[model samples]
Target: MLRVSIAQISPDGTKEENADKVEALIRMARGADLIVFPEYSLGARLEHADRLAEPVDGPLIRRLAAAARESGLAVIMGILESAEGGPYNSVVLMANGDAIVAHRKILLFDALGSIESRYVRPGNMPLTLVRLGEFTVGLATCFELRFPEIFRSLAAAGADLFVVPAAWYAGNLKEEQWLVSAASRAMENVAYLVAADSAARAFVGRSLVVNPWGHVELDLGKGERLVAWEISRDAVDEARSALPLIEMANQHMGTWARVRRIY
Candidate 1:
């Protein structure tokens, strides 16, 4: 069994304050194997994000890495990545005081009158999957949840669990959309989905965990808190065995069969 902690943070202070919240959350979830945080949880600066952007080896990331390692916990969280062209929105999975995988957000949040595309560059690179205990984990950011294609591709690429760190904006029907999207993605791919959302003033805090059977396991409704849930690979196996969606698609020999993409 793998224990995962979800840290739903709505930071209301300076950079130091945000870091303190992260440390406090990690300390609170000391026995969890892994912990996830929302986007912009590190710097407390969601707007004008480029100003506080940093490389993976920068001080902020290093400090976070050390803190998680010190707690004997693996962490996956979002940050603004520094680059010459695209200071991308990225997620880092860290262990042993080092980053194991950094996944940039492929889809920018350009909807709902929020033009993230204006400041952040879209991650054109392929998605990266991280290794957890007996599970292949796929990483995505806020806006990616709107696109089922990305989730489908991740499922095809051998990912059994989806880890999403979202900063979802509060607006008409947005909260319902968040819940539906979480359940839909899990049912469509027959994989577990974990959503860690920011409960900031502008954001509607409804972090969710959906099982492979499209069941909502846990939902943190409108608050800043940390919660844990235990999952096992046997659950994934049971879902796939019942659904057999992957089994139906991957058996054909198409010309582009090298990647095993489902139509």
Candidate 2:
């Protein structure tokens, strides 16, 4: 089993404040294998991404690496990752002094009266999955959850655990959709899924986990929280054997243009 924590906290402060919070969060997740943070967890708001974006190897990231290295833990968190043209709504994973852009949001959030493309550039990176002990962890961002193709691509590439971090907007049925989408993705792929969403006033704060069998294992309702759960690879195996849906439907599931794997 792998212990994973979701830092369901909003990035509603300055860069230094957010970075400090991240360090404190690492300290809080002392015993967990990995921790996941919501999208825009460093930028006070998505609108500020243009001005606040930082390179993968920038000082801010190096500081984050130092924190992770000190804690001897790994973390997945959203950042306004600097790139050509503009920033990418990117999620970075840091472990043992190594950090990489796990996945850039290929599908930007442009619906529900919000156009993320205004400041955020669409990512062309392939699907990224990480190896943690016995499980392959898939990483994706907020808006990507609406598209099952990305999750399916991760599963097709041998992912057993999926992580999604989001700044999901609050709207009529939006919360319901967030819950359903997270669970549906896990069920269809027979993989465990952990989704962390911003707890800010504008976004839904219901961070959740769905087991390999598509059961809601934990639901962190409304507000900042650091919750952890142990996920089993054996459960994924059992779900595949009992359901047999992935084998039958994988061929039809759309694939990403490319795929990348990391340790």
Candidate 2 — what's its lDDT?
Answer: 0.87
lDDT score for residue 224 of model 1 = 84
Worst 10 residues of 1 by lDDT: 247-256
Look at candidate 1 and give me any clashing residue pairs.
Answer: none
Q: Report every candidate's CA lDDT.
A: 0.84, 0.87
Candidate 2 C-alpha lDDT tens digits along 1-263: 88888899977788888888988998888889888898988874667787778888988888888888887779899888988778998999898988888888888888988899888889888889899878899988888898988888788888889999889999999988998899999998999999999988999998989998778999999989999888888898888999877676666544643578996
| lDDT minimum window of 10 residues, candidate 2 | 249-258
Error of 2 at 147 (Å): 0.9
For all predicted structures, in order, the TM-scores are 0.92, 0.93
For candidate 1, report its TM-score.
0.92
Model 1 C-alpha lDDT per residue in residues 1-263, reported as the tens digit of each score? 78999999986666666777887787788889899999877653547677767778877677878888888889998877888886888887888889744688878888767788788888867798878888889888888998988887788888889999988888899999999998999888889999999988888888988999889999999888889999888999999999976556556526446676588
Residue 99 CA error for candidate 1 (Å)?
1.9
